[model samples]
Target chain A: MDQEVINSYIPLFKDAFLLTVKIGWLGIALAFLLGIVCAFILYFKIPVAKTVVRCYVELFRNTPLLVQLFFIYYGLPAVGISISAEVCGVVGLGLLGGSYMTESIRSGLEAIPVIQTESALSLGMTNGQLFKNVILPQAFTISVPGIVANVIFLLKETSVFSAISLMDLMFTAKDLIGLYYNTMESLFLLVIFYVIMLLPVSLAGTFIEKKVRFKMFGD
Target chain B: MEPVLKIEHLNKKFDDFTVLEDINLSIAKGEVVVIVGSSGCGKSTLLRCINGLEDINDGRVLLDGETVNPGSRNLTKSREKIGMVFQSYDLFPHKTILENAILAPMKVQKRSRKEAVEEAMQLLDRVGLASRKDSYPRQLSGGQKQRVAIVRALMMNPEVLLFDEVTAALDPEMVREVLDVILDLAKQKRTMLIVTHEMSFAKAIADRILFLDGGRIIEDSDPKEFFTSPKTERAERFLRTFEYEK
Candidate 1:
């Protein structure tokens, strides 16, 4: 590609990178909230929720994310449920991230012994207090690294939304390619944009994993 | 004197497995009752039922003048009057010893942080762990954790305290320290029910000792008579194993 062309595309790539981050941030925030609620439901085994949660987890986790995204974006709107493609993308990613987050949080919850819950109950703590004060803090600390990794993964996964014309990093790259007919330059720019946007998050995930492991396992 | 606790026909089952069956016992006000039994004989379960930690399938658990019901949604409120220490100590690993000790009083009793910490410091001092108040459970020794747990339970100012083999997890040398603390509390006439395997400690401290086997109270008597003349073969055999340990 020409140096002049590459220089002009840098600004476009920056815009795409920012859009990717916006989608990732919103997706992760929603995922985190849903993950915590699902984790609690699974942890306490509320009513018939254990089986229902198990089915939900298995269904989402076993299926491909592309199919889920397609179903939400293409299938839902046909039935008069007309959510924006951007909202659909964020919600789809959030639900997907929540599936992974639920497993992470549940593992964290399992690492805490049942004796802790019993002790909390014996102390006469309200159920709300027990969940808020005793369980959530420990579970969050234990799940932090996994949740961070999920967020990073979800950041990369945001590229899938481009398939539905969300104007994310990949979508903008495609638009640039169509305009200039320079597929190589646009493709290379897209790769660079994703790498630049995600490298810090990847490093952050690794750093947090190390810190949590150190705190959990000692020195 | 009115009975402080009364257990009549106390039965518990986990699916088809019976943990306790036909347990009828009573403790008078200020009396110390020590339950000595083999593992899986339901001594701990019995104490748990009394404190509303475990629900009995069919039975009556009366604490003071009121009937204790674990089935009720408001059982936690009722549990404020009863405190329990587990064998594993079960201190909240995330909390410091002082925080663990004061949490119940502050949350359940609505005591001020200053008041709760003041009470906790006194209990810590009583348990010989005033210096370790800032330490987490993971930082403390097993014996120290159990002592802190005992102090934590006592901070609730419970009418009845249950110890489910609290010293069983400690080292042999450390066992005496926990026992000494319990003995001191007993001297203060704190209404206590201890589920213990340490026969010597039971023989020394129990105002009355109950020997359990196969989920039934085979023998209930004072330490002197209970040790000297066990009526049931199961109690005799159970006590015989401790003779070699001593």
Candidate 2:
């Protein structure tokens, strides 16, 4: 509620918010793409790719993303492979998100009944027609809620990038507070920034869930 | 006459568990054959094998005198010729009733949307489900869904249709309504292989009844003959049990 203190840090906050948006958006998009590819690779049981994705999902899901961040940002530089903090943040989040995303997508695809698939097959549908008409529509219904939840989680998780000096909203808030000693006011702005970015995403999740259900069941 | 559909010495097994043992059958162009059996008698497996859904350990399924391979890359040509309706009324929950009916023709037959819709509508109208064509599956009753499933199969203009316990999942009252639609199809002389427990419907529609037991057909004869005087002791015992249960 301290306008005098908050107003001074607004310019820095804006840059951090923009950076958060850029990295979070790119990170989530990358995760989604990777998740889809991994899920399909498992679904089709592609020889080498399936095994690779399985091991990747297992490795990432079992560990903490924070440790992964340190390993990528701190540990990679030891081997002469230096990367920007922003790239490290995105890579860490993307791998973590993609691992969970694979499970969500895989389960969503698995929830499609064999009967529905067999019905489409018996109708003489080619692989393309079957996917477009049956599999994709059903998979979307199963995957949407999980995906939206992941997106919001990723938005909040962008704060973790501050450890790598990525200058996200959390880092900006920390800097302003350390200099001005306004802990509550600075943290309040960070919370508002996240809610602004994420509320619509949660709403979109419910909207898509209802629409897909209605299309499938008419209720 | 060359059989429209034939199963020659079809032996199907899953691991060490045998489902069908040296099964052989043939259906003429307009024959209505009913397969009746106790539970676990491989009747449904036989139907699935004919549709190439179940890969037989031995023997081949011939549709129009050509062997249908389950593992073939492009089996659509054979699949489009042999239609199947399941006990669960496996209509696409996402599509409307008409869309379910038209999917095969539009995709496999490569017919234009208008042509497919036109033919699909006629089939739906014939089954008394024309008004429900635009409706989703959940909006309909079990009987209505089963009828829609029948129309969906018929839309392909398949050479033969397989009904694998279509009424097994319906309530008692709903069963008759679904069976009545099949009765109409029977009157039209559509070639069909039916596996059912509804004895009266079988008696009414079947030109021949094949009684299966222990993964073997114990008796294959005219419906009147099979019911009146079952040839095997096992067939007679099966009828006796069903009669006692009723």
Candidate 3:
């Protein structure tokens, strides 16, 4: 309820919000790329790569993002491989998000009826053409909801970046609370900023799901 | 005249059970052959084998004198010339009718979009579905979707057309619309191998009737002769089943 405290924290929250958005989006983009590739590898059952991707998915999915980030940020330096806090945050989030993405996309790919493949093949589509024109588009449309959820999940996971000295929104809020004992104002701004970050993505996801379903089914 | 499609000793098995056994057949150019029997008679499997959809356990299929190998690179090329319309009217649900029709022509045949679309529109118009070209598959009735499927197959200008119970899934009234389309194609002397339980439609459209029973061609004779005086007792019994319905 302190107007002065809230106003004073605005500039700091702004900087943190921008940083969070930057790293969060970068991580999500990387996650999407990794997810698609890994999903295809598993879907097609490509020889050794399938086993490798399966292990990768299991490993990342079972471990918490917090733990993964800890390893990348804190444990890597002992092995003589040091990365910037920003790089560590992005890489950790990307790896974690990618596993969930792979499952989401793999489910989408599997949900496509076998008849679809037979139809495409009967039409004389080469394997590559079938995958590109027929399979990928349908699978992607089917996975939109899951992919969006992963996006939001990965963005929230960026909060843990504070542990590695990244000045993200959560770090900013906690720092303010600890230094100035302004817990109420800081926590209020944190909640507002998080909502600002997630609300549009959630709405966009629902809009896209509806639009795609209508386009596909014409209802 | 050489045969457009030839199957020699074609055998298909799923583990221990044999689906098709030693099926030898040939289809001439511009011929209309209708294969009819009870369900599980391998009629659909025969069409699938000709199109290289299923891997045969023995024997080979030849289209235009070239082998149709299921696992070979030439399978795609062979499939381009063999158009198949399924019972479910397997039109791509995501695409509009026009897109579904024009896809194979554009992507597989490498035809220009304008050319493919132009051909597709004409074919759709032929099937009385030109007005519904922009509609998705789910928006159309079963018959309309089958018509679109027919247009999609015709867009390839294939050497042979295979109809695997194309009207079996349609409503009683809708069956006529799809059958009429096939009957029209028959008038054009298009080479087609159709598998259907519609005995009357089969008799009307078929130049030759192939009655399959237990994975073997029990009878292959002129439609008039086969309809009137079936040689085999099984064919007599199969025809008797249809008579009871009438």
Taking all chains together, each candidate's TM-score versus the true structure is 0.91, 0.96, 0.97
lDDT of each: 0.85, 0.88, 0.91
Largest lDDT belongs to which candidate? 3
Docking class of 1: medium
Give the clash count for model 3. 0
Computed on C-alphas against the true complex, the DockQ of each candidate is 0.55, 0.72, 0.72
TM-score of chain A of 1: 0.87
Clashing pairs for predicted structure model 2, backbone only? none
Q: Count the backbone clashes (under 3 Å) in each candidate.
A: 0, 0, 0
Model 1 native-contact share = 0.57
Order the candidates by lDDT, highest first — what do you get?
Answer: 3, 2, 1
Candidates by TM-score, descending order: 3, 2, 1
- List the candidates ranked by DockQ, beginning with the highest: 3, 2, 1
Q: Once model 1 is optimally superposed onto the true structure by TM-score, how far is the C-alpha of residue A129 displaced, in angstroms?
A: 2.4
How accurate locally is residue A184 in candidate 2, as Cα lDDT from 0 to 100? 86
Can you tell me which runs of candidate 2 are displaced by over 4 Å? A217-219, B244-246
